[model samples]
Target: MTKEIAVLGAGSWGSVLASVLDENGSHVRLWSYNEKQVAQFNETHTNPKYIKNYTFSESITAYHDLAAAIDGVDYILFVVPTQVTRSVARQVAAILKDRNHSVNIIHASKGIEEKTYLRLSQVLSEEIDPENRQSISVLSGPSQAEDVVTHDITLVTVASDNQRAASEIQDLFMNNYFRVYTSDDVIGVEFGAALKNIIALGAGALYGLGYKDNAKAALMTRGLAEISRLGTSFGANPLTFIGLSGVGDIIVTATSTNSRNWRAGNELGRGESLEAVIKNMGMVIEGVATTRAAYELSKKRGVEMPITSAIYHVLYDGADIKETINQLMTREGRSEIG
Candidate 1:
């Protein structure tokens, strides 16, 4: 059965995912909030701003109308930034309510909401009506848009509380170049996806500051330990941290130049102001907001997240990067695994 799917948010990842679905023989309707972007995609069959020099699949159509995008789609894949997810979900829910349609919700965007600190799935559940929402799932791992579009081998995890939904997503997205693994651990998958961006920020900062591979390796290793600690406290399986959504994601996002969070942190370490880095990047850096949320979350949960705290202070509190590193190094030493 060829599934009719609506992909919201025409950013790099969204555009690439839509193209991937089209290549997999699904009819994809890509929705963009920007009318001009929609027109551009329709007229040129490409999104030059995000995915440069790449044309979209002919099976993919672009839409500026939220209702039109949701009209007959069986699944809605949200790829927008986490901060704007609430507003977008409200629009989706309204359209679904009026049409009396139920569709599975799948989100590829990552980041914990700042104030509520809710995962993207939680945000969707709260905004979308239960009757209109069939199930919610998340697709996450080390896959990057640039690499995926070029037919590079990519693997990701699709997780949902509903096993059937997860399996369906895995089937929908799996292909010769892309592989999908199914997991029932929604909490662990989502947290690993969201939290790894924070660590990537630190990793990039270290790189920008002229740190070598040894420092980067240590940051990633210790970073995973902290991520597991916080994630376990919130009812996630500790083993999930060692899997694709955890270590796999950290390795990619921390090291790759394709990561916006890493780029942002790199710029910050290279002595660029946060405002300038954000303006220059021309994309949402999920880690910036995730850092703030994780910092607050660590305090509220009484979970020790020293690396997250150091990055937060540097990014938010105007702490010097060097001083922050010094502070982290001078902290009381403890066991490698506590």
Candidate 2:
């Protein structure tokens, strides 16, 4: 049986996922708010603005109207920016309430809510009416759009407390090139997803500041420790931090120049202003906002996140990069396992 899937937010990642779903014999509907982009997709199956030199699968239809796009679809995958997740989810809920439909909701975006400090999955579940939501799951890892579109071997994890729902998502997305795994540790998976972006920024900063491999090695090693500490304080599984969503994601995002967050951090490390960087990048660099969320959450939970603190000060408080690094390096020592 063929499944009908509606993918919201037809940006680079969303477009790539839409293509993958269509290739797997699913009827794909990709939604975007931009009418011009939708027209471009329908006419040429190309999104040159965001994804250069690539053509989307012609079978995947693009929609400008949200209601029409999701009409009768079995699954809704959100690739929208983290900041607007709730508004979009509420809109989805209103539409589903009228239709009396329940659909599996999944998100590929990573970031914590700036104000609420909730995970994107939590935000989605809170907004979508229970009657209209079959389940809320998250797809997160080091998976990149550019690589996945070219049929590069990519592995990701989908997580939900609902075992059946998690397995269903795993089966729906797995293919020869793209492999999927399921986990019940939703909290850990999400924390790994949202928090790793901050560390990636720091990694790129270290690289930009003329630091060599040893600097990056220390940053990542200690970075994972901070991520685990904060996450476990909030009821996440410590082992999840070692899995694909945790260390695997950190390895890819922090080290890869393809990552928007890494690139932004590179610019920041070279002494550019955050405002200027954001203007030039023209992409949602999630790590900036995620750094803020995690910084605040750490204080509230009394969790010591030194790397996050340094990045937060640099990004939000206008602290000098070198001074922030020096401060972090000189912090009081503790046992490695502490």
Candidate 3:
């Protein structure tokens, strides 16, 4: 049976996911906030501004109207930026309430809300009424849009407290090239997904600052340690950090130029102003905001997230990058396992 799916957001990741669903023989309606871009995508079957030179399937339809996109869809995929998730969720919830409809919800965005410090799934639960929410699941891992579009072998975890919902999403997304795994550890998966981007920024900064492989290795290793420490504090399974969403995602994001967070950090390390980097990138660098949220979370929970703290200082406090590195390196030595 063909599934009717509405995909919110038409950014690079959203567009690519819509295409993948189209390939999977799903009836996909992709919604974008920008009307002009929606029309351009409908006409050209391409999103040039985001994913250059790649054409979407003709079977996929683009929409600017939220109601029209969600009309009669079986599933709704939220792929908007993390900061805008609450606003979009409100709109979606209102529409669903009015229509007396509920659909399975899947969120692909990765970031914690800055002020509330809530995970995307938590934010969705707050905005969307329980009666109007069928089930909520998160899809996260190391996969990149650029690679996935080319049918590269990619693995991701679909996590939800509801086992049936997680299994359904895994079936919907799995293919020969795109592998999906199911995990009940939603907290671990989500935290792993969100926090890796922060470390990716640090990795990129190290590269831009002319640090060698040894430094990058140390950063990622210690980054995973901190990620696990904080995640487990919130009742997450510590073993989840060694899984795909944890170590795998960090490896890809921290090293790849395709990561917006990494690219933003790279620019910052090369002496570009944060404002200039944000303006030039023309994409939401989630780690920039996630760093702040995680920093606050660390302090509130009294978790020692030295790497996150250092990056937060560099981004928000305007601390010298070299000096921050020195501080991290000179911190009192401790055991490898925290």
Residue 160, model 1: Cα distance from true site in angstroms: 0.4
lDDT of 3: 0.94
Better of 1 and 2 by lDDT: 1
What is the Cα-based TM-score of model 2?
0.98
lDDT of 2 by residue, 109-221 (tens): 99999989999888998999888988999998888788899999999999997889899888888899999999988899999999999989999898889998999989998
C-alpha lDDT of all candidate models, in order:
0.93, 0.92, 0.94
Please give, for residues 1-338, the per-residue lDDT of candidate 3 as tens digits.
Answer: 99999999999999998888888889999999999999999999999988888988888999999999999889999999999999999999999999999999999999999889999999999999999999999999998998899998999999999999999888889889999999999999999999999999999899889998999999999999999999999999999999999999999999999998889889988998889999999999999999999999999999999999999999999999999999998999888864
Q: Which candidate is the best by lDDT?
A: 3
Report the number of clashing residue pairs per model. 0, 0, 0
C-alpha positional error of residue 334 in candidate 1 after TM-score superposition, expressed in Å: 0.9
Which residue runs does candidate 1 get wrong by more than 4 Å?
A: none
- Candidate 3 stretches with Cα past 4 Å from truth are none
Candidate 1: tens digits of C-alpha lDDT, residues 136-201: 999999989999999999999999999999999998999999999998888899999999999999
Q: For candidate 3, what's the RMSD? A: 0.7
Regions more than 4 Å wrong, model 2: none
